[model samples]
Target: MSRSTCVPTSEPALVVAVDGPSGSGKSSVSRAVARRFGLRYLDTGAMYRALTWWCLEQGVDLTDPAAVVDAMDAMPLEMGTDPAAPSVRVGSVDVGQAIRQTRVSEQVSAVATNLQVRARMRDLQRRLIHEASEGIVAEGRDITTVVAPDADVRVLLTATELTRLQRRALELHGHAEESAVAATRDQVVRRDRDDSTVSQFVTAADGVRTIDSSSMTFEQVVDALTELVGSRTGRVPRAGSA
Candidate 1:
């Protein structure tokens, strides 16, 4: 894998780009990794969800491409940088919880697939990465390939479909039973299909390391990335730093 890759810039804001499928535990693991190393955290997926929530709030039709792009052009999204308490707000309403609702998950793809919308969000994500003085861990579907390909350390976390489905089921339903997995499959499988049309996240791009989290526990996943960062950057956070 390409874990030893490093950004050549002298800037102190280390941008760690992490891209992965939805059920691959990108958000939670990214947050933990950022906290461990004392870096800002950005959930790029939440930005898309926030836009979807805004479209829904304003009764914008997702099928209308022009309308969706216009809806996101001026959307006021405030993403919290704290790893311990990551938050997403639109205007003054905290839609952090609302964005994760099943409703948003189902319709978010419509907004995410619009080329114009993605371009705008991509610019915002790049600006966020640039503005983080203490560095930032940015995780989403396209961070490695599109958002910040020049990131200091780029990682592509992946897992088998069954493993991803089960993990997502457990996260959504608190159990990974047959019924729960069935219910959660579309969230992973379908959204991935929809997202792939616009971004190449199913496989690792050149120079991006891939970590298979199928058999790994959550702690193990975090440790692997932490060690990878250490291998590349020459420093790893001590245990219990988070």
Candidate 2:
């Protein structure tokens, strides 16, 4: 993992919102940015995935929007904000890892696309952001536009389809070979298509910065975002420190 040598500056009230499609590196980059800036972190997609996991565990009909919304209302979710060890828990079960399984990934879009569910989640997300008094780096599909449109720093991190596909493949599988990319297409491409119906993450919203990471290394992307934050908040990192 690449890391910046610049020491982190304390910015307790700086909220950074990052939005992107699947495999765009929003989660990793946002978490790293949060760590770099001493901010809390929230992965909004994991919230939807946890809901999907709960519905599946409870045998609720994901096809029924009302049931999904009801599930959302009764969900006892605990989201950890620490970027170093973020967790997702539903009730007493620790599902931080289970939510990332293929099962949840396949059904998450169905739960996420529900208009009622999104409305409820928007409220819950706002509350969570408010509670993170020290600041937060919230990343999700609609975060930059819907969830936190007025965050201190809003970013839309994107990359070419091929780049996204390859990255996701490497993360899911162990490599980015053609076979792995082929196996990972549905998870990366189809999910983005379904989720895009409710959020505008493909393009940068007004006053939102867009970081194209197609040719940039992970550290480079993080460095760019760090620099952007510095430019916006006047906490610039030392030149050539990384």
Candidate 3:
């Protein structure tokens, strides 16, 4: 198969931006790509999850957009940008595990959909992307179009609906049975519908390369992105095939 090339750049730092729907393998692919390129990794979803955790802890109503935005405005969130050791700490609580709970999964969209919250997140994300001294791999719903459109490499990683549902079921339930998939439908499908309202990830933006990973293994996806990057950087080093 022919490979796509990233735009050539001399900017001191190379930013690789990837956007995709949930369960499309973008997170795993982006992390693997970051490991390969030795770039800092940023998981933008974790930020919203942490905020959701915060709102629930503070007893803020999810229906009140103004309250949500105010809490997020003062939210003391420290997001670790290293993909190798990605961490999320809300105040004194290390919520890396807490934020991934089903509770946060169900309610995060309420906070993420707040236009003010998104604006604040966009500012923070841009600053984080710029601060990655040795380049970074940032992935989320809007990184390619909204957050880092000028990234050295912008990719839209995607997978089919059935494939995405099955993958998410496996991740959440350790099995991809019908029961598991049914349980995961709302988390993956409903959230995607709600997130699409504020950010576009279901389709690639103009000039953004789209990698459909429906039939690709995790390693294959990583390798494809690496090749895409290498094409621009010229004879780039592989990220170690361990």
Q: Candidate 3 regions off by >4 Å? A: 1-11, 238-241
Clashing residue pairs in candidate 2 are: 12-134
Q: Encode model 2's per-residue lDDT on 155-226: one tens digit a residue.
A: 999999999999999999989999999999999899999988988999898999999999999999999999
Please, what are the lDDT tens digits per residue for candidate 3 over residues 67-143? 99999988899988777788999888899999999999999999889999999999999999999998999999999
- The lDDT of each candidate is 0.92, 0.91, 0.90
Task: Tell me the tens digit of each residue's lDDT in model 1 across 1-242.
Answer: 66787769754777899999988988889999999988999999999999999999999999999999888876888999999998999999999899999999999999999998999899999999999998999999999988999998999999999999998899889999999999998888999999999998889999999999999999999999999988988766856795
TM-score of each: 0.93, 0.92, 0.93
The candidate with the higher TM-score, 2 or 3, is 3
Task: List the RMSD of every prediction in angstroms.
Answer: 6.3, 7.7, 6.9
> Which of candidates 1 and 3 is the stronger one according to lDDT?
1
lDDT value for model 3: 0.90
Better of 2 and 3 by lDDT: 2
RMSD of 3: 6.9
The alpha-carbon deviation from the true structure for residue 111 of candidate 1, after best TM-score superposition, in angstroms, is 0.6
What is the descending TM-score order? Answer: 1, 3, 2
